[model samples]
Target: MEAVLYVLHGSRVKLACEQAISFIETCMEEIPVAIQEYCFLELADPTIEEAYARCVERGAATIIVIPVLLLTAVHAKEDIPNELARVSKQFPNVEMRYSRPIGVHGNMVEILMERLSETGKLIDKDSMVLLIGRGSSDPDVKRDLTTIAGFLKERAGIGRVDTCYLTAAKPGLEEALEIVKQSKYKKIYVVPYLLFTGILMNTIQKTIRKSLADQDKEFILCQYLGYHPLINSVLRQRVIEAGGGQDLVSRHA
Candidate 1:
């Protein structure tokens, strides 16, 4: 039998971690495979090795490891693979295949649109957008986010889409605020390109609320993407590709 080993980047916040596990459960139901288990990379229980062992114990001859990450960061590109490699050395009889992260998928655009709609704000030519991400040291991560911002700018018909980072990268949120301060747009939407709510989301929200309290500019913060149906669809597609003998190549835009 074949199984799917879903890996999520665990968070210290309980709600955030629970959200990832919930997403994994939903993915398990949507995926074609019957046997599936989930684990976290760090800061949570049931590490990757434990999850892989559970799959093997269920009599799985092949295991497809799917990373539920948004970018090609170190976690997706190095840490998860290293853990899988260590475990694969122990399970000589079972074949292990790895899949790419859900980076720059088109469905994500739909999810962002849904989030924007939920805010009850209309996108107009005078509206500005700030696509904020949990920044990484990796250059590819920034490049992919910039590409996503460009797509949103064109498709959503917003006046401008500025890319910013929460930390560890250029154009931090404060700098982004400085840019927003100079812009004459009536409304600026701060879209967080995150999977679930955590310290970062709270921090961003607090910062925006405090800084723009007395300003005339309307600053709207959209909800983070969490367990959306489109995400489930993307997970299923990645599993299918991995099970079909495709190698784990860089699939980002």
Candidate 2:
């Protein structure tokens, strides 16, 4: 039977990894294809090679391998490609394809805009709005966050929106938060650029919450982006539309 392998980027939190898989499972319920799944690279278990091998062993002549990542960061581009190349060498006959990560799509724009709109309703236009991302060392990842923030700023009609990272590189969240505070705005909002729930999110929220105690109680901490109902259909259409090599595996969550 034909099989589609939705490969997750292993998470530090076991629950995060499991959540990613669960998101995909819900998406695949309607697709007629036989679905197989795996998580390799980073944390957790089952390396990509093992998953590819398993698919080949199961008589899957064509395996669609989707890398369930948010953006085209180093791990998504370098690590996944290197592993796929190695796997391709072993199973020369199994047609496999890799699509770009789901980033900056119209639907993603919708998600951000929706969040900002809802938040904007709670605050006055004079209040400075800050779009906080988890931040990544990868420049491309950072660019994605900035671009998304820019889009939301225009849609929400907010005068200002700034991007900040959590760790790695410079300009961490504290620096960004402080800058906004100096503006002496009545309130500030921080949005998580993350897809899954995990320790990084918890830590960031705690830091923000603690800092907010000194400020006006109106400080806003928006929720992390997750598997919303429309997201499953958005991911499905993304893979279906952004096609590459024949038999190339495309996965989304």
Candidate 3:
């Protein structure tokens, strides 16, 4: 039997974990597979080993592992793969395939734009967008985010879009905010490029609130990207490709 295993980057927040579970469960229902399971990469229940064992116990001969991540970072490149490799040794008889994260895509840009639009504020040439990422030591994280910022600039017809990180990269959130504060643009939109709500989301809200107190500029903090329908479509495409649906993958490629 064939199986699909969705790997999510777990969170310490209970609501964050619950949101992940809820989103994945909804996605599972749409996939035409009997043995579909989800596990966390860290900070949550059902480790990768536990989920892989369940698939094997349920008579799964082949398992396709999909990393539910926003961008290609160290967790997607190293940690998850390392864990999967360890479990694959035990399941020597079973064939396992790994899929890519939800990397740079047009759909992601649409999600960002929709998030900004939901603020009910006009996104005009005077509006500046501060695109924030979860930060990674990997250079690809910065590169990919910069690309997305450019896409957003064109998509929204904005004059400028800036990219920043929460940690491990420059300019940090504080530095980016200070720069934006000094800029002429008064209408600033801060968008968190994250999948779900957690400590990071809370921190962003708090930080923005603090910034608002001191600055005269309008700092509009948008919502995090959480289980949007476009994301469901993206994950479905990834699952299909990982499960040997090469024709569909090639179409996107």
Candidate 4:
């Protein structure tokens, strides 16, 4: 069987890792290929190099390196490519393809919509919706956030979606929350634009609780976008694109 190697940005807990595993595994249904392994960029076992070694050992001729990243930051543009070059040298017989980060895809908005509605509260069209991203120094990474926010706006019925950052960028969650509160809207939803639960998500939630308790602002902090099936669909597209399979652009569209 063929193999696909998922290159995830690692996390601290086994649950998050398991989420990544399940995310990719669900995507694997379309391919008659085998899942060689799932590896991490850091903070967990089975790093990318190790996954490549296993793929090479298994005589896999093609491997797809899907970065389970929200944005194409330094990790995807610089680190992943450099590592892929090294992996290529080690496994000359196997060709590897690196895919765009998960953020660039459109299915994410569907997940975001589902996540937003998960609160059982329809986003007030007149209110402000702050879409918080795990910001990055990379321009490409930042651009993806803007694109997603704008897409949500175009979709409508979710209110005016505004962009903000959790870290490493401007207009932090606090600032966005302040903007929304000052506006006529009484309710503000701070949507965490993360793939899984982690330190950042934890910090955001705590900060929200404390801020509300202190200022007595009315805000609802929803959970991070847990391993959604739409994400699984996006991952499959990336894997298929990297695997040199049929055109998947329309599928992603």
The numbered model that scores best in lDDT is 3
lDDT of 2 at 111: 78
lDDT of each: 0.86, 0.71, 0.90, 0.75
Cα lDDT for residue 33, candidate 2: 55
- Which is the winner by lDDT between candidate 2 and candidate 4? 4
Which prediction has the highest TM-score against the true structure?
Answer: 3
> Worst 10-residue stretch by lDDT in candidate 3?
244-253
What is the clash count of model 4? 0
Query: Which digits, one per residue and each the tens of the lDDT, describe model 3 over residues 1-253?
Result: 7788999999889998999999999988777778889999999999999999999999899898999999989999999999999999998999998999999999999999899988999987678999999999999999889999999999889999999999899998888998999999989999999988878888888888877776878999999888888888889899787877854333433
TM per candidate: 0.94, 0.86, 0.95, 0.89
The lowest-lDDT stretch of 10 consecutive residues in candidate 4 is 244-253
Model 4: per-residue lDDT, tens digit, 45-133?
A: 78889988898788777677778788778988889889889778977777777788786667888777777678887566555567888
Q: Candidate 1 on 109-225: residue-level lDDT in tens?
A: 888888888999888877988889999999989988988888877778777889899988999998899888888887998889999888999899888987786788899999887
Backbone clashes, each candidate? 0, 6, 0, 0
Sort by TM-score, best first: 3, 1, 4, 2
Residue pairs whose backbone atoms clash in candidate 4: none
- lDDT computed for candidate 2: 0.71
Identify the superior model by TM-score, candidate 2 or candidate 4: 4
Query: Is candidate 2 or 3 superior in TM-score?
Result: 3
Model 4: CA > 4 A from native? 213-217, 247-253
